[model samples]
Target: MNDILIQNTTAFFEKSFGSVPQKVVLSPGRINIIGEHIDYNDGYVLPAAIDKIICFAFEKNDSKKSKIIAIDLNEEFEIDLTQEVKLSKVVWTNYIRGVIKQLQDNGFSFEGFNCVFSSNIPVGSGLSSSAALECGMIYGIKELFNLDIQKLDISLLGQKAEHWVGINCGIMDQFSSVHGLENKVIKLDCNTLEYEYHNADFKDYSLILMDSNVKHSLFTSEYNTRRIECEEGLAIIKAEFPEIKSFRDCSEEQVLNLKNKMSEKVFSRVHFVVKEINRVVKACEALDQGNIEVLGQLLFETHYGLSQEYEVSCEELDMLVNTAKDDDAIIGSRLMGGGFGGCTINLIKKGHENDIKSKFSNLYLDTFGIELKFYDVKISNGTTLL
Candidate 1:
């Protein structure tokens, strides 16, 4: 599949630019297994890069302008390296422009270059395709210019670029995109930026994502509102418990005790974060012990919390989880990513992958009248030159 993507991208670049690219980079999309909405609370998250990736083919240009083509979108844009980086009216070009703007903000100058890019990651499916694009472009730029920026810094730059584009995303996506390891899940401390790799050998199970194919309109607004509610709850809690920092440090009992002081909405938001943080720790332990059952249970618990408490899960996502609940071959399934509507990560028995996908696809189409999309994903190394 990767070979096909490479050949197609190379062919596109040669056809578009009239020459082969001098450098090629591959940046992968990511999947968050158990943790959700906790990254912004300075909590822990478990995410891994998947095999689906975005590829960038580039070559330095003699002129002072950078030409970029979005192979998938069949769109093209030009940027003057000498001019100040600004937002593009074209939405897709904004990501690339944001990266250039971020690098410029950090005292790095970019040379004019020609880039052709393509992605296999499904859009709006919670796979972090934007992060892949941002990271791949910056990493390629780092190599093309012989810059000394580290991988971690590149992730940060990518994240900043997203922020510039008005997403207000956490570092998890970019971090996983840059530092992902094959067959491993990264336990990241969102507050301290500390991480440790845990072996994710699913033995006889495979990691798969079922896209709900319905993105709710409330995703962006509700996401910001959730963040605000968390802050409001924290402020009320901090006044009473000076020692408590984030939801990570606050216990369930602590929040329960202060439950009367905050609104139900704020309480639910804080409660989900505190509980989800602990679940991530337990999920990591389950992975380390190779206990797939325990991990599966945790995934179900996470979906419930996100649905009832965090209020991020919609009918399509909940239905996807519910549809697989009775299947013994399916161990764990939950709504992954920022939620309102996206993919649900599932741990399914290896041999039953196709059967489960087929059953779920038919059920989803019957229920929602929307076709479901499935991706049989494996953990893969992060961004790389190919």
Candidate 2:
């Protein structure tokens, strides 16, 4: 897959620029093992970079004007570095423009360049394809320009770029894209940018992402609403318990106590975060002890909390996760990413993967008329030049 992607990107670059690309970057999408919707709440999220990636080829034009080609979408966008940064009308171009804008805003000046890119990351699947693009662009540019930037800064810049592009996302996607290590998961603190990598070697089990191929229109608005609701509940709790700093520090008892003061919606959101945060803690411990069965149960608990308590899930997602209860081979399964519609990350025994995929796909098609696409993913290194 890497070889084909590299060959295709290089060929496209040569065709577009009449010469080979000076640099290439591959940035992988991410998966959160347990914690969800807790990153902005100052909770730790365990995420790892996956094999799904966005590939890019870049070369300096040595001119103010730059052209970018989205090889997959067959779209072209052009910009001039000398001009003031403005948001692009084209949505995808904004990712490219956002990264460039972030670089300039940080006083990292460099000339415009030509780029061609392709991606295998499924769109709207909650794999964070946008982060892969943002990180890939910055990493390629940094290499092409010999810029003195650290990996952590690369993540922050990609995150800021997304905020500029109107996503208002947390840092997990970009952080995992830039800091991921092969065969490991990073236990990262969202508050202090502190992290440690844990071995992710599941001896007899494998990870797979089964995309529901269903996206609810309410995702963006509800995502913002979730953030606001969490903050409202957190403020209420902090007022009662002055020692409580964020949802990470707030106890389940404290949240339950303030349920009357806050609305049911806000209360549920806070309740989910508090419990989900503790689940992350236990999940790390479970992995440390190589007790994957405990980890799988924790994932199921998180799905319930997300679907019921947090109220971010839809009927399709509920149905998808519901099917897992019957299959003993399927240990862990949940609606991943921002909730409404996307993929469910599952951990199942190696031999039963095909049977599970076949069963799930047929069920989805019969029930919803949408095709279920499953991806077999491995823990892979972060963004790198190839």
RMSD vs true structure, all candidates = 0.9, 0.8
Candidate 2: worst 10 consecutive residues by lDDT? 201-210
lDDT of 2 by residue, 243-353 (tens): 988888888988887889999899989999999999999999999999888888898899999999998888888888889867899888898999889989888988998
* Runs with alpha carbons beyond 4 Å of true place in candidate 2: none
Q: Per-candidate TM vs. native?
A: 0.98, 0.99
Residue 170 of model 1, lDDT score? 86
| Prediction 1 global C-alpha lDDT | 0.92
lDDT by candidate, in order shown: 0.92, 0.91
TM-score, predicted candidate 2 vs. hidden true structure? 0.99
Candidate 1 lDDT over residue span 134-166, tens digit each:
999999999888888999999999999999998
Model 1 scores worst on lDDT over the 10 consecutive residues at: 80-89
